[model samples]
Target: FMDNSKNMDIDYKKARTFLDAGLTYPTGLGLGLKIKVNGNYAVNLKFNGKADLNAIMNNPRNAHFAFQFVPSGSLELASTLAVDADVVESGVKVSANLHSSTGTDLTVKVLDGYGVDVKLGLPVKKQEILNFHSDVFSVIREKTGSEVETPVKFNVKREDHGGCFDQLNTLTGLTVCGEVSVPLDGFKVLSPAYGPSKASLRIEKEDESLTAYHFRAFYDNKQPDKLSLEVLLDTPNSKTDRKFLLTAKGSMKPQKQLLIVMESPLTVPTTFEAVVIDTELEQAIAAKLTSDTAAYFIKIGAHISGDINRRKYEPILEYKFPETAALSDKGWIGRKGVKGGRQQQQSAVGISGAIYVEKNPGTAYRQYELQSVTLNTPNIKVTVDGTITIDANLIATDLKASYEKDTLTLNSKIQKLGERKYIARVDILPSKYP
Candidate 1:
C-alpha cells in the first residue's frame, strides 16, 4: 500500500494559519493629511501602519510627505502618498513604503486608466523578496476579431509563471482627503472611496506586516472558489537581511472542467498537484521539478470499458532528463514587405507535435497521429505527414494544401490524402452484386 499520509502538504499548514488570523474589511480610516503643491498639483498622505501619529503633513508633495527615515528595529510605519495635476489628464502616483526595520521604499506609477493593475511588493519593506504571486484572473473586456459581433467573455487565463503568487490590486487612483474640503491648486480633485467623516489612514501600534494577504473571489457570491494564504515572518536583528515568506493557494472550478489545484510556491524548484475530472475525461497528475534537468511526473487516468462491469485504468510514470526533452525553439522571423522595399519575401521553419485520440459511441475509432512537422502562417502552405489508424488498417499519407480566402484548398496526390484510407477499406468490405 502507498503511504499517502506521509505526503508533505503545505495546504494544511496554510489553512490553519490564515483562518486563525481572520478577515478584516477595508475601512475608511478617518481624515488623513492633505497639502497643496502648485497651481495645478496637490498631494494627499495616508499612514495605516503601526507608527507614530503625525497630524501636520508638511511639504506634502508625493514622496516629500513621508515621515523622516527611521533606523532599523524601531517604530513600524506603513504609509502611502498620492499626487494629482491637470497635466497628462492625471498626475503620476507615488507610494511611500515604511518598514519596522529598514528605511522606506518608493514606487512610482503613471495613471494610464487601464481599469486594472497589479503591483507586487509587501506593505513591509523586508518582506519583498518572497513576494507571492497567485494566478487569479479578473474580468476584462476586449473585442477579438473584426468579424465577431460582441466582445469576448471572461476566462481564467492560465499563465505559466514567467514570474507574482498573490494577485495585487492595481495601484489605486488619486484619493482626496475626505473630511476637510481642501481643494487642489487647479484641476478638479476626484472623490475617495469613502465619505468625508472617515480617516484616510488609521495609525495603530499593531500594523499588518503581511500587507496584502487576504483575498476573496466570488462568481455570484454564493461561496468563494479561490483561497490565497501567505505568511511573512521576519527574524530579529535584521536591517540588510531580507525577510522570508511562505505561500500556498487552493482553487476550485466547479462549473468548468471540474478542476482542483493546490500549489506551493517554489519558484526555483517548481512543483504542482492537480486533479482534472470532467465529463469527457478523468486524470490526476502530480509533478515536481527539483532542478533544471531533473523532473518527475506520476499520473493516473480512469476510463470506462466496453463491459460495464470492468473498468480500465492507466498508470503512468514519466521522468524527463536534460538530453531527451527537446524544448520548443524560436521560429523564423523576417519582414514580409516594407513600403519602399521590393516586397521583401522571407520564410522560416519550426517543429511541433500533437497526439489526439477520439471515439464515437459505436463507430470506428479515430486517432489523430502526430504530424512529422510543419510551419503554419497567414501566407504560407504546408504538408501533413502523419500515420493514422482506423479500426484495422494503417494509412501513411503526405498531404499538401494551401489556405486562402478563409478556405483550405487541398491540392496534392491521390485525390489526395483521406480517400486512400476509404478505398482500401472498401476492397475489404463485402460487395453487393445485383
Candidate 2:
C-alpha cells in the first residue's frame, strides 16, 4: 500500500456506419463499444457516430497522423548535438546542415543506404528540393570547406529552318587592325529548338603554338545558334583570363553568305584560316596580271676603248662637222662626221687631231715640244721636236691629247700658222659641248 497502485488497465473499441436502403427494405444505425483493464494493460469502450461512406481516404494534400515507438529506452532522438547532413536520392544529392539541440552542427554518416557523410547547413522550415533523374549533381566539401566547381548551364532557342543551316568560311590576313570570325557550327544548331544547348570549340593560330590555342563554349538561349570563340594569348605564359576583349556581329541572310568582321589591335602576330568569305578585305592585295598594258624596259651594257690620257699627243678633240655640229649631241658618230667634213669640204670648217707633249730630246726638256700631227683636210704630216715655232691658219681637224712633262698639246690641220707664242686661225673647230 505504501509503494504503488496497480497501473490503470485500459482498453477501447469503436465502430460507426451510415447507409441507405433505397427500397426501404432495411434501414440501419449501429454503434459498438467495449472496455477491459488489468495491472499492466487496459481497454475502454467507444461510441458510434454518423459516418460518410463517400469520404475520401488517404488524402496526401492534407496532414496525416503517424506514430513510431523506439523500443530502446534510449531512443536517441538523434544525437543531442548533431550536424544536419545531405540527403541524396535519384541523381541529385542535396547537401545542407543539420544541427543538434546544442546548436552543434551534424553530418550525415550514411545516405541512400550508402556510406558517406553528406554535411548539411541549418535546416529550413519549408524546403523544396529538386531532383533530376537524367542528370547528376553532387556537392562535396573541401578540406578548407570551399566550393570548387565549374558551373555548367545550358539554354536553347528556336529559329527558322532557312536561318539554321546557312554556313560560311573565310581567310583573312590582318596587319595591326583587323580580325575574322569563323563559324564552328551549322546554322540551325539548337535542337529540340528548346532543349539543352552547348557551344563546341576548336582553336588554332596562323602559326600553331601553345600561346595560340584558346577558346570557350557557352549557350545563350536568346541566340539561336551555338556560339564559338577564339582568343589569342598575348604572351606564351599569360595567366590572366579574358585579357583580350572580343565581340562578334553577323547575319543569316537573304544575303547569301555569312560575313563576320572583327576589329582588334595587332597585339600579336596571328593568322586565321577559313573555308569561305562573303566580303573582301579593304586592304587585301590584288593578283598581278601578266598582260599588263605598260611594262618597264631597261637598257644596260658597255662600250670598249682605251685610256684617252695615254695618247702620244695632247690631241685637240672635236666632234661633229662645220664647227656648228657638236660631239655631245652626236656622241661617237658625231666625231666621225666631223672628220668626214674635214676631208670632203676642204674648207677646214671642221677639225680634230692629236698633239703629243714633247721634251728636248736627250736633254729633259722643260717646255712645249710638239710630236706629230696628221690632218685629213690636206693630209698634212709634220714631225715635231724641240721648240720649233710654226704659223698657219690652222683649222684643227681632230685633236687628241696626251701628257709629256706635264705640258698640253694640240695636233690639227693648219688653216694659218703663227709664231710659237700662240696660233690664231679662222674656221677652227673646237671640242664637243663640254
TM-score of each: 0.22, 0.12
Per-residue alpha-carbon lDDT of model 1 for 102-220, expressed as tens digits? 23322222222211112232344332111111111112212342211222222322213121212221211112111123223233223211111111221121222323222222222
lDDT of 2: 0.25
Q: lDDT scores for all predictions?
A: 0.28, 0.25
Candidate 2 regions exceeding 4 Å error are 1-311, 317-333, 337-354, 358-367, 374-434
In Å, residue 368's CA in model 2 sits off its true spot by 3.5
Task: Identify the runs in model 1 with alpha carbons over 4 angstroms from their true place.
Answer: 1-223, 235-239, 254-273, 278-280, 290-294, 321-434
Per lDDT, the best of the predicted structures is 1
Which consecutive 10 residues in model 1 have the weakest lDDT in total? 11-20
Best by TM-score: 1
